[model samples]
Target: MPLPNGYSINAASSDESEDAERLIETVSVPPQCCSARLNLAVLMFFGFSVVYGLRVNLSVAMVAMVNNTDPKPWENHSVVPAACPRSSGAENTSDTFQQPDGVPQYPWDSETQGWLLGAFFFGYLCTQIPGGYLSGHYGGKLFLGLGVLGTAALTVLTPLAARMGSYWLFALRALEGFGEGVTYPAMMAMWARWAPPLERSRLMTLSGSGGNFGAFLALPLTGYICQALGWPAVFYLFGGAGCLWAVFWFSLVSDDPRTHPRISKEEKDYIINAIGPQGTGHGWSVPVLSMLLSVPLWAIIVTQMCANWSYYTLLTSLPSYMNNILHFDLQSNGFLSALPYLGAWLVSTLSGVVADKLIEKKVLSVTNVRKLFTLIGQILPAVFLVLVSYSGCSHILTVTFLTLSTTIGGTSASGVFINQIDIAPRYAGFLLGITNTFGTIPGIVAPIATGYFTEDNTLAGWRKVFWVSAGIGVCGAIVFTIFGSGELQPWAVTEEERAETDKRRSGSISQ
Candidate 1:
């Protein structure tokens, strides 16, 4: 009754070679010095960091990207005339890139800026489902790496695109979005294969936090780059870094432990056994109708949409908000704009550890844990968002509230984001893709809507935008708390999978 490679399993009478090979993969910690899974998490963390780095650099650069000499096009559409003072030379710096007096300027307004920010999501929206399917069926290694590489290549072309015209710049940004759209779903598929249930929150959030980290770095870094090397250098530097990352990504990582060359045998055995049956195969259908009708799935979709509404709004608009409302200069605006995401990254990192411990110790049911954290992520941000609106010109108070909102919302990393895996580990990729499709809608809509409201860049208009965000947050929290769940559905298993289960059970009994 010796196990394969000295591996032991609680279940007896398993003679299948695949089972033997797999059981060898899952276990308690091996005698190895380090876990390969940890390495994968680290790579994935930095991978997502690179994705957001390329994505958000434009937002920071936008402050210095265009001329403010003429009245913004949306000024006529204003709720009230924008009384905010434009940045003077002392704050803006006499960088040749800004070249406000001497250089040619694009004829864009707040509305046009919103369109540019939102255009990425238009192309981003098109590829989610296909990306999920491709990553799951084919392996995420190629999809994830190529996706980042494509985005990096496009990013370097952004300055040239901007020089062409507004429409051209928009098109280029959309193309970049198309490349990046695959990232989350591919990462989800890969994590489905790698993450143990107990360790799920920790690993997934560690990777997810990279997005916040990217935002954290990009705002300040891009601002400084724009100040020194000019706006184009921001694109060149981040894009080049992304290209280098792609080279390292291809060399360093694989989709799963089974394929990773450097992983230890004991660690491989531990992963396979701990992960249980991965009910995936070629020609698998995604159970589309069931997913559409599922309450928990819809809850995730709605909540994510709400979250992204606030997140994308802030990501795209925060610099302008600071610049206009509180009168922070470009460098100060970038520094202040990045602060909230730093809080977000910190919260996400801490909450991941706390969530895993709660589930591991059985202090809360998985369903309840998701609901609790989702509520925290939702309601706290709603409250703080409203507080931010009212705080008005009080710089310290406004920043603190914005930071709290982002930090609390970061709990969703462990909550709704990882809940898909709890309920549908086999199909987590597709599930995330579906939810993210809804989630990305906010990315498309929020900036545009905020722009329309804040066209005059007046405090009254900005207040309206925050109010709308808070309302959506409340509705999402309510719906998700009532309908969300973490239990696997029966339909998650195919007929073949059920038969395999029965056969394994019968074999164990007959022994």
Candidate 2:
């Protein structure tokens, strides 16, 4: 099927009506090797898994690293703390923080711990734009592989750094963050050379969901590793795994389809044909002024910042909320915190397939599909998040609402999350760098915002946090619905090609 915008996919025409239709032929090659693009997706998946694993392991590992005999700030505030009555099976579940048997635990207070936890974002912010540009100019494979490898090397030194001083560990984590910051944007650069338009959703989702799955695995498993071995082993094992994965990535993946040693010519031809001349670079400088002024670009940016505010708020604060209000113990909190991501991982993977199917069948135009899923991902989650706020101290209701919020949010994998590629395939990485830099604001600010709102740790304060998240999510969805486009932006092309690339159906793909 040929799209007016010049994208062609091996899909059947929409209707069997009066119009003569042709079946787009499929590429049939000798079974000499599995699909290289598919292999790239898998490698990208594990790379993302390692990315998130290293990122979140510290959340769990630090608990064992700290000697927290002091009562929690909320508990110590009132003469008789107002807390939910302990549920059945929650007795003696008051989080008893034991210093890991053999390892030395730090005497750092909560303020110090907070800084340590946030140190990663400091360095993470440094590399976004540079990473995206450099990866595009050069190859993403080097930066992506080196970034992970560097982070792994730093992770191995975490235990040593912690033993030296609080400042040492903080600096080390910041370095690790700087190293890993290239990952998201670099991967986008890689995909620009590889992912076909129809396959974009599934390919991106397959990799993106790895972060969710990584969190699902890391959260609970980190605790288990710490308990069974020692706190140091948590860093050692995950870091080692990252190093091993980097070796495989470097060995197996390449930057461009044209240069891939093992890729089949027939498959490569199909990719080239589907993507056309635009798949390769257009040999023009990026249209910075046009990108700055573009409405759709701003729409996507606003939506990302707002959406990420909601996402990061829950990611960083959910454990504390459960522990404080819902009355789950640390161990239970870890498992429960991980559960939402499990649902998210499953939904993200499935929604991707559904999205591709919808576009292929012409059930909805690509723009509508993006809008529909963004609405589902962003707006619908607001309702459930509100339900979570009102659910009060009910553990079952809160968990259910939160899970519903997260699972529904997974549709973004098909929606605005991947819209960067739709709008600007050539600049997808740079665009992601811009948006994610804004998105990272939430990662830094949300935790701090949640802290400010819930300083008293009252049910009302916690309710405010969820309400704000829901409100931000709603606002983002509204902006995206109004201005977002799946049709490529005019700025994405060279000035010469811009006029010839007449506006595609802004809402639909059909004639």
On lDDT, the leading prediction is 1
lDDT of 2 by residue, 127-153 (tens): 887788777767689999999999988
* Per-structure clash totals for the candidates: 12, 0
Candidate 1 segments exceeding 4 Å error: 1-27, 31-33, 69-104, 279-282, 494-511
- Backbone collision tally, model 2: 0
TM-score of each: 0.89, 0.87
Q: Each candidate: what lDDT? A: 0.79, 0.76
lDDT of 1 by residue, 1-511 (tens): 1134332221222243333333334335664236888888788888888898898888878877866523443355444444444445455432223533433456578899999989999989888888888887776788889999999999999889999999999999999988888889888888878876667888899888999999999998988887777788889999998999999899989887888899988878667766655523324667788878888888899888988898899998998787666666677788889998998898998888898777666677667778888899989999999999898677789889998998889998888878887777777887777888889999999989988998877888999999999999888889889999866656565454466557666776999
- Model 2: CA > 4 A from native: 1-33, 69-82, 87-92, 106-112, 282-284, 495-511
